[model samples]
Target: MKKKTKIIISVVAFVVAAIVTTGYIIISGMQKNLDNLKSIESNDVDLSKISDGTYSGSYKVLPISVEVSVTVKDHKITAIDLLKHDNGKGKAAETIINDVIKADSLKVDAVTGATYSSKVILLAIEDALSIATETNNK
Candidate 1:
């Protein structure tokens, strides 16, 4: 009976340790993604110069990623097309282009159920806009 009790305790401890380690890894990964999102916000590419031609932008967020191409003419956005999107149940994020077209800016709100994907899509669009603005500047 003594030996059996010791074995059970050890097994429980091992299982608890495994669970804790897994949780830690998951939390750390989540933090890193959050940090990346913060970095995107800081890039601060001016949208005013986004004129003419088509530009592409992409951003990866672990299980999901976004690739968007935007067309602009005379400083107005003509179209927004999804070159690639690894969205998971985030069909709402697909409307990023339409929202930007309606607002004429990236300050629009994210879709309720697909907030993360929406932000990522917006970030990709921001990246495309950055490139477009840079090219126009040159």
Candidate 2:
């Protein structure tokens, strides 16, 4: 083969290998993140044990993350503010906060189309309330 043809072929092969490697890494990370999210189980927190105050928490599962501020008053979840949410096609999952406030619990159903996002949000809320529970226990 001509020297120029060999060089061109080598470059093309290198580019293909780079692309394939990058794709594999991304897919692998995504699969691992999904598995982590699936394994997340929101803990049952006792609201009555939580004091009246606002607490902050966050949960991240690559490509999806949530930060929440939960307000408790008279042992009830008065409100939930989503400080930050990084999601793909899960914007609708924000409404899950309302369901949580209404139920005053973390056992609410995940949003239909945004189940992953919903779970992350719930976990963040749980994280925040868990702090309160811990504080009260001390």
Candidate 3:
């Protein structure tokens, strides 16, 4: 009976260790992904080059992801729609879109506390605009 009890304890300990290790790895990966966002700079897309149409773009970084639809008219941004925003405590970053539209460029500042999400949002906008720029260049 004592041997059986010891085996059970050993198994539980091993299981706990495995769980802890997995959690640590996951947390480390997430931190690395977030850190990578610090160096990501959004390109200033020339709206004049983009045709009059709606473009869709998406960007993901671990805990934060964004999908945006940007509508341009007469070489100007008319509207921006955030179709999907998956974030943890980064909802304030949504206002960053307004800054982009107001500035007519992606070089606007990020939200105060939601910097990671702000960068991700800007990157997604850049991705969408790039499609238009590429199409026009071709």
RMSD of 1: 4.0
| Among all candidates shown, the one with the greatest TM-score | 3
Candidate 1 residues lying further than 4 Å off, grouped into runs, are 1-28, 31-48
Candidate lDDT (C-alpha), each:
0.80, 0.92, 0.92
lDDT of 2 by residue, 1-138 (tens): 699999999999999999999999998998799787888799879988999999999998878899999999999999999999999989999999999999988999999999899999999999999988998899
Q: Is candidate 1 or candidate 2 better by TM-score?
A: 2
What lDDT tens digits, residue by residue, belong to model 3 across residues 1-138? 999999999999999999999999999999999999999888898887988999999999998999999998988888899999999989999999888888888999899999999999999999989987888889
Give the residue spans of candidate 2 off by over 4 A. none
Q: Under the 3 Å rule for N, CA and C atoms, how many clashes does model 2 have? A: 0
Candidate order by decreasing TM-score? 3, 2, 1
TM-score of predicted structure 3: 0.96
Better of 1 and 2 by lDDT: 2
Estimate candidate 2's alpha-carbon lDDT, on a 0 to 1 scale. Answer: 0.92
Show how many residue pairs clash in every candidate, following the order shown: 0, 0, 0
lDDT, candidate 3, equals: 0.92
| Candidate 3 segments exceeding 4 Å error | none
Model 3: colliding residue pairs: none
Model 1, span 1-138: residue lDDT tens: 999999999999999999999999987997688567655551445556666788998888865698988887777777889988886687787876698888767888778888778888888888898877778779
